[model samples]
Target: MAEEDEGPQKAVADPETYRESLDAWMKMQMPAAEDLRVHAVDMPRATGFSNETVFFSATWSQAGEQTTHRYVARIEPPDGGLFPIQTRECEISCELQHRIMSAIKDSGVAPIPELLPFEPDTGVLGRPFFVMEFIEGLVPADVPRYTQAGFLVDDATPADRERMVRDAVETMGALAGLDWRTMGLDWLDVKAKGQPSLQDQIELYRDYVDRELSGREHPILSASLDWLDANAPSAPVGISWGDSRLGNMIWKNYRCASVCDWEAVSLCPPEADIGWFVMFDRMSYDDFDVPRLEGFPTREEQVAIWEAKSGRTVGHTIDYWEIFGAMRFDAIMIKLGDRMARAGIVPAEPGISIDNGTTDGLGRLLERQGVSL
Candidate 1:
């Protein structure tokens, strides 16, 4: 979920165009509001290079009274965005996101924005998109590195920061505890084996790396994949919030108000999500050699909180999952870097995407674990 230095040049179409299209669409959804208007359409600067996210406000009439509501639209990227294979193949479609969030909202297991119906017709906005109630809360900014600057570091007291961490972990635990089958989310098990096996998750990424590389050699990823195949551990199949991190949550009153970003939602073990959460903390602080902000719980402390909240044991298995998280992240970087280069946001050259901090971190992790390249 790393943000590029410069915003993607064409993350969305013209705001005016969106305003027009969305206005008409919202009318259909609310036929009673004859004077409904969509305005203030915009793309947030801090959004990562994943789905194109647009925020706008709509004003309409109800009972002869004017009312306004803010909403966010998640659009499919023209270039398939990050995780190109998943988006292109419909493994991670907007409809799936809508269904997942809707289930989670009904389960009340976690906080999610209220959603509208999913719009599968690309003609609505040039791509499939879903509109949801815009949540009013502060999201940890990815562009500025929340550790260095943001309400997370600059304004929040130590106690507040601690509370944020605890609350986020608790939310994750709640989500992990949910039963996908009971929630009618069995379709997320892409392999359709009753549940998504750990091996299937690993192979999915291996296939992703191969497709993203297109024959380009990535030694660190290859070695990590080999190690994973040989040392895969068994764990309960549970819900994975795919990209779990502080940046993905919207906070209100130092507590998680809404959980966003469901493109990576899967049926992997809960450990995968925890691994991602911890791995990103390392990337934000340790990888950059930045001192972690005061008051945030240590890695062990955070895991302990998760254990208590989720009622699950996470022992050495976390080490394996952390490496798994790193590998998945590195694989995504390959596609992300290429997308940036092609957009002229970064230099276009060989190895421009692969030879970077993510790969380096993956290499160091393998070395520390005695996995030789």
Candidate 2:
């Protein structure tokens, strides 16, 4: 469910104190700086659903000169997140996240942001977090659904949109093209549990959906999940950036400047990433009931571009993964919806029809594949 962001949301943490803490922490990290101070810290208007992000500017004097830097910190949720605490054996640690990006820094798949550090200790920020060099660029709005209205839709040229899409697809291809084994990232591999990787993921989501709904039946979501199990793809696991899409990319010059949001990064067939990329892009238009913006590649065009860039034929398996992607996002929305309901933000609809758009989208995708839902 790619729901629109109503407006600029507030930060979960205070800016002034957080900046002071960050200033002290960075000073310790830089032993050489005699006088290290954070000039300012600002929580950008845009906030992510899962993590609390903070931006800071600091100036430190080493010897007789002063140097300045801007950094971004991604703090993990303390209680829990939208998704379940990933199974430890198959989980992504903050250290692993840092390693993943570091390994691919030279791959040309995407502009890799420089990572500052991965702090596992929570005492500093009341939760575990990591930092990266701040990248100045425009990101398509997730809350506003870029297609509905935004800097991207309102001001970006049609040619700019096309280049953005192309760059994103190519970046995804570059990520999938990397040698995971050589990169020493085999720790991310999950045993299929006597089932295929695709099916394993579906069951995980099914269980989460059950938890989210408290065993309440989500007919359309359940139907889509069942269809995915019945029509699972046979492709082997590869490096699938779990949250692949244009919105996840920070853009400059209409091309991907840096790829963000790797919390759901996983090992799945390349089709999984392709499916996510296409489904999420479509959700912006589908959920908003708007026409696809001009120059943005169609689903077919996206797949073809990825195939050309990654050198892997999408073949017929993409539909199965697309359903899986929808189901995955559906389960997330269910949990997120439940969270909102508890907070009195929205009514808790028993039928969970609020996810109808996502389910409807999934149903149509299944039908297009000739699978009865």
Error of 2 at 226 (Å): 2.1
Lowest summed lDDT over 10 consecutive residues: which window, candidate 1?
83-92
| Per-model CA lDDT versus the true structure | 0.82, 0.74
How would you encode candidate 2's per-residue C-alpha lDDT over 1-373 as one tens digit per residue?
Answer: 3435343223337788788788888988888987888867887643234677788888888889988889888776433456543356334345455656776675666788988777866668766678899989998887778898887788989898889898899888877787666666665655524223655567777777777677576777888877878777577666777889878889888978898877676666777888898888777877678998888888889898888988888877777767778878777777667666666666766534345567678778768877665
Please state the error at residue 212 of candidate 1 in Å.
1.5
* TM-score of model number 1: 0.92
Off by over 4 Å in 1: 1-12, 45-48, 84-89
lDDT per residue as tens, model 1, 64-86:
89999999998876665464233
Q: Superposing all C-alpha atoms, what RMSD in Å does each candidate have to the true structure?
A: 5.3, 6.1
Candidate 1: residue 220 lDDT (0-100)? 90
| Cα lDDT for residue 251, candidate 2 | 87
Q: Estimate each model's TM-score.
A: 0.92, 0.88
lDDT of 1: 0.82
